[model samples]
Target: MRDLTSTEEFHELAANSPVVFMFTAGWCPDCRVIDPIMPEVESTFSDYTFVSVNRDAFIDLCIEKDIYGIPSFLAYANGSESGRLVSKDRKTQEEIEAFLSNLSK
Candidate 1:
């Protein structure tokens, strides 16, 4: 997963292709819990471009998008939002996979 560098980059990526932005932060335990499984998840859903966005660095963007949670996922396809799995709860691998799977439908 690529780390988000700038807000401009976020917009450019979202507009260009199927992208999944993962909102996370260093201090978030829930975010770290899924770190080990992320590589596998990315491979399982190879069609989408995965990005890691630090909640601290992009607080403004988070507020704009109404993301009041850590370890959230926002998917974009064809320049529009397709789905989201936003919450303050810890996400299991199955749940993450299910969310991505549902996005395809």
Candidate 2:
């Protein structure tokens, strides 16, 4: 997963192809849980570009995007929002896979 440090970089990446913005924070436990499994998730959904955005680092952007929780996922395709799997709930690998499956539909 690519780390997006700024909103500009996020927009640039999301403009062309399918992109999934993973809103996370270093101190977030849920985020840590998903960390190790992300490589597999990325490989499974190779069609989409995955970008990691640190919510704490980009507070304003997170607010603007209505990212209220860590380990949230927002999908964008062709500069438009395609899907979202955002919540305050702890996520499992199956749930993540389901989210990607839904996005494809």
lDDT of each: 0.95, 0.87
Error of 2 at 98 (Å): 0.7
Please write out the lDDT profile of model 2 over residues 9-68, one tens digit for every residue: 887777777999999988899999989999999999999989999888898988888889
- By lDDT, the best candidate is 1
**What stretches of model 1 exceed 4 Å from their correct place?**
none
| TM-score of every model versus the real structure | 0.97, 0.93
Candidate 2's TM-score reads: 0.93
On TM-score, the candidate that comes out on top is 1
lDDT of 2 at 34: 86
Q: What is the alpha-carbon lDDT of model 1 when measured against the actual structure?
A: 0.95
Q: What's model 1's TM-score?
A: 0.97
Give the per-residue lDDT of model 1 (tens digit) for 1-105. Answer: 999999999999899989999999999999999999999999999999999999999999999998999899999998999999999999999999999998852
Cα error of candidate 1 at position 40, Å: 0.3
